[model samples]
Target: MAFSQQLPQGVTDLYADDYELKQALTGQLQHVISSYGYQPIQTPTFEYYDLFMNVPGTMNSDQMIKLIDRDGKVLVLRPDATVPIARMVAQSQSEVETYNKFLYVTNIFRMESGESDRSSRSFSQVGVEWFDDAHPLNDIEMIVMAIESLKQSGLKNIQLELGQAGFFQSLLQEAGLTIEQQLVVQQKVDEKNEYELSRLLTQYQVNDQIKNQLIQLPSLFGSPNYVITEAEKIAVNRGMKQSLKRLVELVNQLEQLGYAHYISIDLGLVNHLNYYSGTMFQGYIEGYGKPIIQGGRYDQLTKYFDLETSAIGFGIYLDDLISIVKKQQSFKTNQLETVDVVTEEKDFVKAMEFAQELRGKGVVVNMHYENDSTTGDPVIYLSEKKVEIKGETFTFTTVEDFLTKAGFKNGNN
Candidate 1:
């Protein structure tokens, strides 16, 4: 492809050795997932629209990259991987145990053609989903694994912010607001506009106690203990208690993980994903300025695929991870040597043999005979009688002497 056909904007070609960086992050994330017994999984980059649309916060048809199949049915590039993965787990699994854990890394496409403030329209997300597990311990484990994954990825100065979706949802349920009013409150929460939430709650007619509680929800963020202390003071109706208890148990387990220092609770965080029916959380690194990882318990998510189970999990935003690693002072980009072996057809057999020999010893070798010696900053010139490697030239009376000089002891020798 010519440079004229290069990507328009917000997209970059990885000309540098980004593979090493990606491999480091992938290996660490997979290590944590494996230690936690979560299996790796993959799904198609495009799927039937019906799969994701069942869940809210999924982009509309216009926002997705929609295409028509030969049969005239609509197909979409997967905006997110979790939904397709959930569909797969539900339809593919026949186990009676009713518990499943999965981890995946995939690209998510979005319509950001006109957006400013953001550079890329297409981004990558890494996340995990668990099906049919409702225990509070399940939520805590997910958060801990997120912390572990980041730390294992060589990141520090990270914070884990926990939020209970049910907390705010229960409050809204009791607020007696019309669906429209509830939407107003939700919009405020999504925007993190606390002043509007307060003004609206005060003006609206509702139970004063509930109004005050709802108003306070937006400001309810602090250490887990502090947030829980405030949360317990709220009227503990049956619905409220269920959500509160889950939060408490999750915090207790998180404390046990010795990660309580990195943990905070934000009662205001309402994830866009509605299927996250229970505890929802996000991971943040200092310089990333956005959630580097996001996952939560989505109990109702599997039901869309005809499986009924309580589940929760998270996705690691790999692009976000790379961004953070880029900012972090400790993370270093590795430099690797590039070798291009030039040989004529007469020397091709010997070149092949030498290349295989270098490969077996774990050297990164590139065999190309046409490289302009003047252009390569470092060059290697090889011949049967002499070898010039990295500006040093050595002549040998024969190939046997050359091999001996290079310390290549032939197995057949």
Candidate 2:
């Protein structure tokens, strides 16, 4: 098979309007996250494969794209930003601080299952990680930012489904399920397969009361007020009770902040990443199949690197997000109009000077010789004796007259 004209599966090139739209989306996200005091940071594009292997539940090894270094060490394209960021924070600080916040815009590489052409193996992500903050306010702040991010992206009809990992982890502990059994239950619950979940619980001969609550887990989703009330009734132990309390507080605060309409509860919401230790949530917009925004508390992630502080953050799948933005026609790209300067060879020097002047005033300028076809808006035809703009011809004089006639007064477009 010839490969000259083909790109590898699951990768793509962004050009023209698509590329500009992506840039616009990225800039909006950066502005929104930065306003929350998150300074930008970056990690290497590749890291030692062991960095992920050492942290169980970080990512499936099969999904990571790997290569061998010259010295025979194995490396992988950065599959996740959170893991590498956590590693960096752990290695840099002698002692964990009370608060640390950072943001990043980078690409992650991973292999997708199923049809390769239908899925992306590489894509950009915009996200932030907050370290050493476990207060419910921290979780609330993350959720609020996630909501604001989608809203700022020009997405309407957004929903943020909130959950707590501890809610179900506690239920599993109370059921006394082994590691293997717990994984199976989590998968079923995440799938919302009540029948399979019930059959599995019955097969394990779980206590009737606990089994019933386990079956109820998948259905424990809806308005926070209703879900919290129902979840309290099924609270089997203190762990389950505490998880509900924390979620209530978060929802209440969000409600107070006027974001109640965007909040929903999903007790069965399970993140693929194992680092999450507490509050977890995902943001979605109408018509998208997957969550555009995902985040949660992972107080245990840094401990693997010997830094015991708490951490929580979220990542927005930028490629998928831009697609949604394009479909909704919600985000309008501020396409800059270019001014083309067409001139004869003899007038080239003067045309160049005029082009530079327009550029200095923040206008986009493209220089063109007389015969060259022009594509930009507001074409300017300059010659020794005449200046023509928009079909209005003026006898060539001082640059100021042309500037004023072009509607660029005092450098303000």
Question: Which model scores highest in lDDT?
Answer: 2
TM-score of 2: 0.92
lDDT of each: 0.73, 0.85
Please state the error at residue 64 of candidate 1 in Å.
2.3
TM-score of model 1 (CA atoms): 0.84
Per-residue lDDT of candidate 1, residues 80-194 (tens digit): 7778887887777785264477778788876665632235657767677777548666667777788888887889898988888888888789888986688678768866787
Q: What is the lDDT of residue 280 in candidate 1?
A: 79
Clashing residue pair totals per candidate (backbone < 3 A): 9, 0
Runs of candidate 1 with Cα error greater than 4 angstroms are 1-10, 56-58, 96-99, 112-119, 199-208, 329-346, 367-379, 384-413
- Models 1 onward score TM values of 0.84, 0.92
